[model samples]
Target chain A: MSSCKFINTPALLLDLEIVQRNARLMLDRCQKLGVQLRPHMKTHKTLECADIMTGGSRRCIVVSTLAEASFYADRGYDDILYAYPLPFDKVERCAQLSERLSLFHVLLDNSLALQQLKKRPLSHGKIWHTAGVELTGIYAHCGNTYGCKGEEQIKAVAQQTTAITLQFMEKLKAIGIQGPKSSIGSTPSCSHPVPEMAMLSEVHPGNYVFYDVQQSLIGSCKLEDVAVRVLTRVIGHYPHRNQLLVDCGWTALSLDGGGRLPTGYAIIEGHPELKLTSMTQEHGRVEPISGELDFSQFPLGSVLTFIPHHACATAAMHPVYYVHSKGKIVDTWKPTRGW
Target chain B: MSSCKFINTPALLLDLEIVQRNARLMLDRCQKLGVQLRPHMKTHKTLECADIMTGGSRRCIVVSTLAEASFYADRGYDDILYAYPLPFDKVERCAQLSERLSLFHVLLDNSLALQQLKKRPLSHGKIWHTAGVELTGIYAHCGNTYGCKGEEQIKAVAQQTTAITLQFMEKLKAIGIQGPKSSIGSTPSCSHPVPEMAMLSEVHPGNYVFYDVQQSLIGSCKLEDVAVRVLTRVIGHYPHRNQLLVDCGWTALSLDGGGRLPTGYAIIEGHPELKLTSMTQEHGRVEPISGELDFSQFPLGSVLTFIPHHACATAAMHPVYYVHSKGKIVDTWKPTRGW
Candidate 1:
């Protein structure tokens, strides 16, 4: 059989060893800090990977979608925080899963979403009311570099949260809903978290898994902390035009521009100046502004390393991670869900 | 049972009826043009969708990767085109698959790719070589918006064809290979193609499937002919700030910046001045120029339409199509491959 046939080009291949090391590193870091680590499963959709990360804790998880919550819940993951704003249309699923699972939390940032959730009339005898209405949380995305840029902007989220909570309460009372949890998280803002503002429950930050290009640019993490890098092959060169093409395209990587990160296809590791500058569907174009390095070293089929813009977003684009220990494949992990 | 669950809030959804209509429309268009239609399967990876698009003909398909090639080929599609540049590392797969399938055409813009394809010694016998190489076609991507522009660039591609052919023969001889086919396509350069220059047998243009922001920018198709659009809901409003956040995000639509197009996000049908201006992971920020129109008319939960930049690229982002028939979902069609 042809080797590497299973590993298709334009497919995301993660280094599992790096991933495991990354996960364990975070777990240990959190253990030292004495903070409850609720690793976001959005970075690795595989149930197996989650088990490894949590060490079979069935511990709390931060999910980007209710579907993720459902997937993990089916796999017996009981405590989960659906960290995105509750889509008003999806409140029923939230209420239903909340009843079945030990704990399921939904987030709402705006009055309209809370109003929609309120529209789901809670029957007095429903099982959902018993397990916990208080478990439902609200997340206010504050100080996102792509949108709100500064500390001044972070304050805007606080102001907005206060206003939103008041309106949220009014709708809850109208629908006769009881106490719910309050929570907030934005990695950029959480570094200087207003814990009092997210006073009701836990904080969920995903990017701390593998800080990337946008994180480094936003000062959320240093360049050294980046754990994930896409291994790509250089295919063509036109020195006179100052360009080279790499095999990693959006399909192999992802299309997330990461809000306000330095805009480029990807950050070239080892060679700082050579960024994956532009791309089409199947090719990445790299342009270096400084001295002309010997691209011939990469030649027509040399592999290069890359740091993605958003680790969570980029991870969602790939199918499997090739777990490597010191650059040789040891194990492979597959994501459980992607659609 | 629970309603169909969308994994993520901002994920792409296909209205099945609209998708069917889209397939029918494209099929009819190609039939009228007297050109054999090969729908780029990259847009929709589902087997069900591919069956409808191919109209029972899976002999020739345009794929973006070997994963897709192998995927469809396993499902009985024999003729395939790995349309992107065939990297040196992948030539063996091409040669191996040629032994099984009737044909597999690969695109090549530079001589380096050909050299790499030649570098691999064929693992198959002479019969495989003659049949496979004869069926294999080369494509020139001399029409990138950033690439050599206008007639001069087009002529450069034509002039380079002689050298390309001579180099191809020399490389084939050097590597003991023969019979590779030559082809050229790039909508910008091949729309009114100079066929005699390169001895091209067939033209492959996937973007001609559904013209979008990029195609429109490049003057390929008019805005009215665009077949696909993302239907999003106005989920939030900072009315005083003149910004409305919609449900479509980089996840639902895509992170394509409309590359060299007049419009950034998808085009808003009736509102010519309105742009889907900015996007985050789950929110599309729409901005209305002062005194032009009040976008609050959309309010919360109102649906709006958007045309993507590159139809094939944007289509790859979503798993299903919202198939509409005169503004209502009549059916749901699931793509064959995806999460």
Candidate 2:
């Protein structure tokens, strides 16, 4: 059986034990808060993890792309929410998908989208009716939460998102639409305990599954709680420059950084003194935080794992993940990517 | 016949005519400089585009990952170079592939990798012999050239990279290996008319096939020469915040910005006043340069195209490309992705 040492470098590695623990933590937190957990599958876009996150019941999940919605919908996952604002170009596919699935929801924050949806021709060549296309909810993402400075700023953004969502719900109600749930959330706001909107039926938080350096800096999860990492090999050492090059680059880890984190790109798992300073398409330049790096410790071919700045963007780079449990390869999961 | 309006949103659209023109320009430039053009396939990893770039010869190509090497080799593209430094764990696979292909090369920059390659055991249970594994060339990326300010700095980086590659070639010769080509290049140095290293056998310039906003900012290519773009739709308009949200986000475009470009994220095609200031997973927040946006001009559901900051990272996000010629999709090409 393939194990950590046998797997290729620059592969996505997941600690299944840690992932399960994270899932349980988030699940229990939502249960305690008396809100339904509709975990976002955009981070780990695989059915196996989605099944575990929803406790083996593929009831509710959020997707970032229409390709994901179609992938899950094909596999008997009916309660799927395309969390991004609805694209008018995909109205036909959305309507057809809505007809097949029990609940295929599309989120929109503008009135023009509502008018377009209202005017779309159904299969019978008439204007859209409530019975023709079923929407599970109308949700708004408070993406600005990522820019929040602290608890006060996060709470303010959350309240603002909640108010906007309620206003959209009222707009829906005025247009003879009823009973659709209202949802609003982001990783920071969902992780915080205060300012929970009671009117919202569900929360869709994707990054809590594998909190990265960015989330940790935002106080959402600790560094050690990060479950996913890119397994790379040190290929070259430039001791004169106090730098080393790794096999992981922007193609493996992603170019999502310069956040509140001290490290520019990613954090070296157990080496605070080391920093991934820069990257090319296929080579990452790592350097010592201070004077010089001892190249002998990390000889060429030695493995070094990195905790990425943004888990969602980093995870999207890999096609398959090497799932491990207690330092052994347990399984391999392939995520459905692309639109 | 599929046109721009009929295709799905967040789709990768490639203008075949533009791509061909870009390819011909680079190829002709390399020929005039008396240097071989080994186009790097990392940007557009499809055999179709590779054929066009190589003039249907499939002779020499640079790949960032083993996956690309294998994909091209399987399709009979024998002269493949794994441009990234060899990963320790993938050494065995590389050796096996070397035996099967006409020419498969691995790059190295440090002595440790050379020692590892020297010590690897062959199929006969003996130390690796030159006959056991064949190398195409020794290559060094003047990746630091991207940080260079102008012609002098770029030329300096080019000279440094050429020196390092020649030094590595000398080391290879000292170990009783001889007659392997030495190469060095990056887009900046390759695009510049000066600093042409006559000693280098070839140059691998990948991003030149589809120049990006970053490349244009670097003065590698004109803005109009950019061949790839992401087709998206305006999804929301927050007139109060002077913000407009597009369906294209970091997932579709990429977070590869903060270059010398005036716009931080991307350049919206035909809209100079707008800047894509921020992005979520599947939502890009666009805003005007100064005043509030005229919401009527960019109504929700209207389409807006964006030329990404980095073409390679942006292309990697899409699985397939809609190849358009004269406003119609003439073909579709799927890129092989994964490591």
The per-prediction i-RMS, to one decimal, reads 4.8, 1.6
Q: Is model 2 an incorrect, acceptable, medium or high docking prediction?
A: medium
- Could you say which candidate leads in lDDT? 2
Q: Cα RMSD (Å) per model? A: 6.1, 3.6
RMSD of 1: 6.1
TM-score of each: 0.78, 0.90
Q: What share of the true interface contacts does candidate 2 keep?
A: 0.81
- Single out the weakest 10-residue window by summed lDDT for candidate 2 chain B: B124-133
Where's the lowest-lDDT run of ten residues in candidate 1 chain A?
A: A124-133
Segments in model 2 whose C-alpha atoms lie over 4 Å from true places: A121-138, A148-180, A195-199, B121-138, B148-178, B193-196
Q: Write the per-residue lDDT of candidate 1 for residues A1-339, one digit (tens) a residue.
A: 122223444444444554566567666654554445676777667787788667679778878666678888888898887765556556788888776776666665466666666666544343332113343544444534335545556556645654565566558769876565444455554443443443334445566556677766665556666767777777777788777888877765777773223437677777767767766666788877466756666676666777788776677666676555555556666664432
TM-score of chain A as modeled in candidate 2: 0.89
Runs of candidate 1 with Cα error greater than 4 angstroms are A1-37, A52-55, A109-138, A145-182, A189-200, A239-242, A258-263, A336-339, B1-40, B45-55, B107-138, B145-182, B188-200, B258-263, B292-296, B328-339
lDDT of 2 by residue, B223-287 (tens): 89999899988888787788888888777888887532465588889999988888777888888
- Best candidate, DockQ: 2
